[model samples]
Target: MAASPELEGTESPAPRGPRELRLYGLNAVHAAFAKRPEAIRKLYLVQSRIPALQPLLAWCVAHRVGYRVVEEADLEKLSGSAHHEGVVADVLRAEPESLSTWLRDLPAGPQLAIWLDGVGNPHNLGAILRSAAHFGVAAVLLPKHSSLALSGAAARVAEGGAEHVPMVRLGRTDNALAQLRGAGFALAATVVAGGRDVFAADLPTRLVYVMGAEGEGMDRELARACDLQLSIPGTGAVESLNVAAATAVLLAAWRSRRPG
Candidate 1:
């Protein structure tokens, strides 16, 4: 252990409202209701859209969730987005699971996780979470110093994927990597060069796909920690895929290789 390198990290932004996370749009609101209705502190709907939202309203009433039927403009103001689609909610805070918790809970089969250097943008984070859910990733671990916060915009972009996948905050990168290795997860770091082609390579069932900021790529130490360095083969003139696009591609590959 090289003095632990002063590992530091921050939890994803705390829920926006007083012990609540502001959520908007049909997909996000529906996910919140479906997966954790008890966490809904308050809900808002456009008056004209009530008929279309009756089922959700009924559930809110049955669950004793506070709600207000307001004009569409009110929803716009609340959500700060024109595409709110007439639904918004102040859902309760969701505490992120610890890295150790998820690792300990792994089932008997191979596990899949996305270990991110950091989420440079909320939309990118949302998109990655959506892909993670689609491919059944157990969790997404962010670097300790990551400034990325799962904001309302992120939830909207995720289209409910945020509710399905867990976001884990990591401490010293090396420490987490070591624990993962001990747990039998083979780390595969993504790189632009000097790596195996992800699609054709032999992938481990218990694996963590490592992705870093595009401009800097993975840090030297992090790259050295991986069991196999890999890349998504591409022939396009573009220099490289953005983090979200690359993640989706890699995840799809994982899904294809282990189809049910």
Candidate 2:
């Protein structure tokens, strides 16, 4: 939630837009620029990164966007993270879309999505976004009460995956389920145990994988409501794989069965 580095007196006023976010890391900044170049309000980078970011620099000069060449330590201090990767940008945060809007605009196909029941870790969310982008996931469904939102660390960890995936806000649980069912999507609850093996199960064409939190797991009522319960087979080595890793595995399984 930290804002980007403030420009000195030399810079002009930032353009009005959505909430601003400080995005460090080369790939994260690059992705934001590639997706919405106009959203970039200000930029700060070490001299060494200039060559790789020549296009962006050219855009900044043409548009009169504020940019500064500072020392590595200055970037570290400004971004409040050592992983700035010699570049940082102030960009407008992409807002989440309502369920109705997303559903209305979604194209019909063998689409895939994930419903985050209680997954809250930013790193896990980033990893899930990365996997979701890799597997062509349509949207990330967030529950009504969920507090999850895109953050600087999550974007950095996603390695540009965040730009490709849209976070969608769900309505009432039952209503959301009804809408998805009407859209020809099957809900599959991913449980730690007592479920059909993912590798052997007959996956649906339009499927939404419901993932729960780490310790408390999915809500009992929600899990029971799903059309199918799925579990990844493991040797009971250490309870289960992390939620992000499990998501990647489940998505891969689905894609393998229905390759495009």
Candidate 3:
């Protein structure tokens, strides 16, 4: 190998911060129109394609929401992604709840929360957040090191849930679990190999359902910290269900068991 591509001076691109360019697709935009019109900053539509998006336009007009007719290129440029689906709406950043404040305000009754352990995928995180919101979860906690803030895809997938739910960034999983336990919430982790079936477990009134990352389940220490390790009953055909699907199942089961 004569001069195998010799290394030349190369500079890596600068790391980017949380997504500044937010694009809401058709479905997400429609949902915002119905639930959070005030959050929308600007709506961009193609003039020729106005007929297809009449409802959106009408809602914007009725709400006095500002909008503009722009070309497809402009939408792509603004979104910084090609999956905008012909409609893009710029929105203001939704206010986030402080982790300490959320925890401090817990009422003197049962509460439900979701803890995400090293869940790296934004789509999965977003889906789980949506499920958490649907079942009226009290809060969602994530280990600061392994989890990421809500992203554009997450915002889109979450629909309106991202705006409604509270997200907490705890620095360490073990410490977070300890705090939850002290607060009278039972910690339960979803495990694959050895754990009780979620459906049969007598879940406590206050619960923190800890979900692990894809492929790699919870770490041994974290699993041991859980008051119980639970598994979803499923056919043994697949390795394991996606984290998001499992989250929905567990959440639904938990919600059903709540006392009226």
Give the clash count for each candidate. Answer: 1, 0, 0
What TM value does model 1 have? Answer: 0.89
Q: Candidates 1 and 3: which is better by TM-score?
A: 1
lDDT of each: 0.81, 0.88, 0.73
What count of clashes does model 3 give? 0
lDDT of 2 at 38: 89
lDDT of 2: 0.88
What is the lDDT, from 0 to 100, of the residue 3 in candidate 1? 13
lDDT of 3 by residue, 218-242 (tens): 7778888788989988889987889
What is the C-alpha local distance difference test score of candidate 3?
0.73
lDDT of 1 by residue, 165-206 (tens): 988877787788888888889999898877899889989988
Q: Estimate each model's TM-score.
A: 0.89, 0.92, 0.78
Q: Residue by residue across 1-260, what tens digits does model 2's lDDT show?
A: 22334533324233234498778889989998899998898898988999999999999999999888888766676566778899878888888898889889999889999999999998899899989999999999999999998777788889989999999999999999999999999999999999999999999999999999977888999999999999999999889999999999999999999867
